[model samples]
Target: MDKEKVEQLKIQMQQWLNEAEEFINHIPPVQLYTAVGVVLFTLILLLIIRLFKRTTSNTIILTGLSGSGKTYLFYQLRDGSAHQGTVTSMEPNEDSFILHSEKDKKGKLKLVHIVDVPGHSRLRPKLDEFLPQAAGVVFVVDSVEFLPNFRPASEYLYEILTKASVVKKKVPVLLLCNKVDKVTAHTAEFIRKQLEKEIDKLRTSRTAVSDADISNEYTLGVPGEPFAFSQCHNSIIIAEASGLTGEISQLEKFIRENVKP
Candidate 1:
């Protein structure tokens, strides 16, 4: 019975196809030509959209102090695994792929180009290579060890926010406080306030020093008031994450918000 039904369906499909061809054959030549032209135009338009999406800025830069776990977070984003005990990466960990969180989506997502710039003092300069084209910047901070590294981290972040490339492009910055799984980890709000205070002091000191010393390409924060991130030209978002335990949804959200799939 099933076989007979299959054969009948096939025959019906063939008859329908023949009827469709006959109907198309009767269409006026000009109308048929117009229909073909419209289809071709639509196909070309879709192709252009695909090409444009492929070329759009997909870069998300990850940078922070050596021990802030930015490299670990980078691994988490790319592989969804911490790859524990990762020493300070000497070189930038860079790749282009669909985010690990979007792995199940196959073929329907855009590739993200992530540049995990090494946070070492020497390697930090390499960040400039990718910053100009970055869709967003994820600056990881070690919330559990926040106080000890606050100065250098603040200085590094200050330089970044003040850089000509970041300021001119107005690239959004995500202040990611990592290692949040730890009980000792600081809250995102506290971290933000401390960072603001540190940056405010640095801004004043930079102003006191020679313009060359500060590389004063673009002044940061308001001239008179204390430096709050809100005063900056670009948008700043504060969020927490735990790279080891893979609680990085907020981080992923920021990337998607800026770099469309």
Candidate 2:
């Protein structure tokens, strides 16, 4: 071919390449915006899932009479064994939230934040503050002592239930009949029945009002009902300060099932 023809061919090829580059640069802004939007949307989705997990977790507050095993359960939950003695009140500097995480039988994660409040009658006044913070209440009862200590336990239960009801929230209650291994006749089923009877009696007494008795009346706060009542199915009770392994696991499972997350 001639040099002039070759030069013309080169010029036509250069012009074609320049036009292609300009056309590429003029591509729609919508496509570029869509690419950026996808990246931002992915980031937002991840953040929402993380926030949902944190928000849906439940917090439980354990309350019962002194020597009712609230502290024992707390220690068992923390260490996976009830080997430690009842945890005494912490110093002013210590944090109040005792958070523990354990895996369920199916390998699902279970998080529990147990607020251990003082069980003595004197500390009853402080329950108002604690009860409202908890999503559920684990009311530990000493099964062996129930016969001798029934009056005080019943009164305490009434008070707690009333206080809980006044807030217009029906929190689930787990009646942990602790120390069941000590008694020969007191099976978990038996304890459950007795407690249910006692609860019914309490409810009846509160609601029973004669026509003439309307002069003076009293009302309960919790509506004379329990949120969730169950017996501790484990046989090894009397969770000593050394450790309460068998019973604690049962209690943990019960909580995970009934307590909403």
Candidate 3:
């Protein structure tokens, strides 16, 4: 009886296979090819979109004038402690890792690729090499010594804000005022107003020069009005941090916002 049932089941399976083959054979060559092409095209398009999203940059650039404490901030973010006596870096300090603050979390987190570009006049050109891949730029400032370095700091920031890569891509910038734990540190609001004033002055003088003579790919601010961070195409945020005391929550927040977990 078992053998007889097995034979019937085999015949039923063979009949289904034959019917399926006949149905396929009845399909016109054009219709079959079109259906296959549609499926293949859809798969290729989905694959391309996935690749594009995965390629989205995870780089965060820390840049500012010499003595602005960018290196300290970089180390603090990666190591969670200020490694003492860190002098001005001659070369770019770069690393890809999960932020030290996030390491204690339970689940897997995305690694942030951070580049601390040296702020010396000659090394400033190196910033162009990494700006293309930057998810966000943190322009560090020495809040305790801001007044003395205000002009130069603003000039450097002006150059960065005008770059074609920064402007065209609308890469967000965080005007990070570092070393705010000190007694005489300036407020982030004060530093922001001062920077806006200085950048406005720069815009005036720079716009007078012929476009060919200017290295900046795009002019900053509106032609007739005063320049403000709010007027730029890219978003500019001002925040405070103390790399020395490891009070970098704002900086970490900015990084996480730009480079998601």
Candidate 4:
């Protein structure tokens, strides 16, 4: 703190700087340039990696016709129990949270952005806002009552599979058959086959119409071939779940596979 001590420290700091400068001057120019380049490259690389990780998507979209148990599944993921009997959502129900099932896992966990888009036809367009950044999509179906909703579900699913974002980005889709807890619930295979059949019919009807009436920009499947989910550019998978009974391991698996946490 004294003036003499401060002067001594300043002199020592100057000497250190001079020594550093002299050492650098003595080094070969090529080696010095290489060292500088390496450091700058490393810094740039680290910055780029940080930006990519930050921008990586944690979003998972839940979409299906109304009463297919998407809301139930959404609550079950966030709260570990379905908040049953609530009114249907007019808009998307979204939140960033660690899955309740993963709550007991050790160490820090990444948050998942779950967006449960309303299944009503009028609200389906809202899905476009989230599809670009989505890590995955779950298309729910009311398994027990699937027959009544089959045509509409096929149309919705066709639109999703053909979306530019979904097809180009290769966004993975999980077709979920919900209400499997009921004794009369359809099997996953049956639902998949029936959906294929329905979509095949829709593909024919829609392709025959004008583009103005056709909401799908991209074609659904191979021309003159029977429609199947395997024809999709992106991965289209079938799964089953029971929101009420909490049999959702498959759904959780799909989320973890895409989100990495």
TM-score of 3: 0.84
lDDT of 1 by residue, 1-261 (tens): 699999999999999999999999999999999999999999999999997764468999999999889878888998999994278888888899888989988567878889988889988889989987898999999999999999999999999998888888789999999999999999999999999999999888877777677673578787788889999999999999999999999999999988887
TM, every model:
0.77, 0.56, 0.84, 0.81
lDDT of 3 by residue, 11-96 (tens): 99999999999999999999999999999999999999998875578999999999999989988999998894279999999999
Residue pairs with backbone atoms closer than 3 Å in model 2 (clashes): 82-243, 82-244, 83-242, 83-243
Worst 10 residues of 3 by lDDT: 207-216
Q: Go through the candidates in order and give each one's C-alpha lDDT.
A: 0.90, 0.59, 0.93, 0.90
Residue range 156-211, candidate 2, lDDT tens digits: 77566555232245555666777766734255566555655665577566556574
| Candidate that scores best on lDDT | 3
Report the lDDT of model 1 for residue 159.
91
Model 4 quality (TM-score): 0.81
Per-prediction CA RMSD (Å): 14.5, 15.2, 11.4, 9.1
**Residue 243 Cα positional deviation in candidate 3, in Å, after optimal superposition:** 0.4
What are the runs in model 2 whose C-alpha is more than 4 Å off? 1-57, 86-110, 164-167, 183-185, 197-245, 258-261
For model 4, how does the per-residue alpha-carbon lDDT over 74-144 read when each residue is reduced to its tens digit?
99889988875266888899999999999999988889999999999999999999998998999999999
Write down the lDDT that model 1 would get: 0.90
Candidate 2 residue-wise lDDT at 92: 11
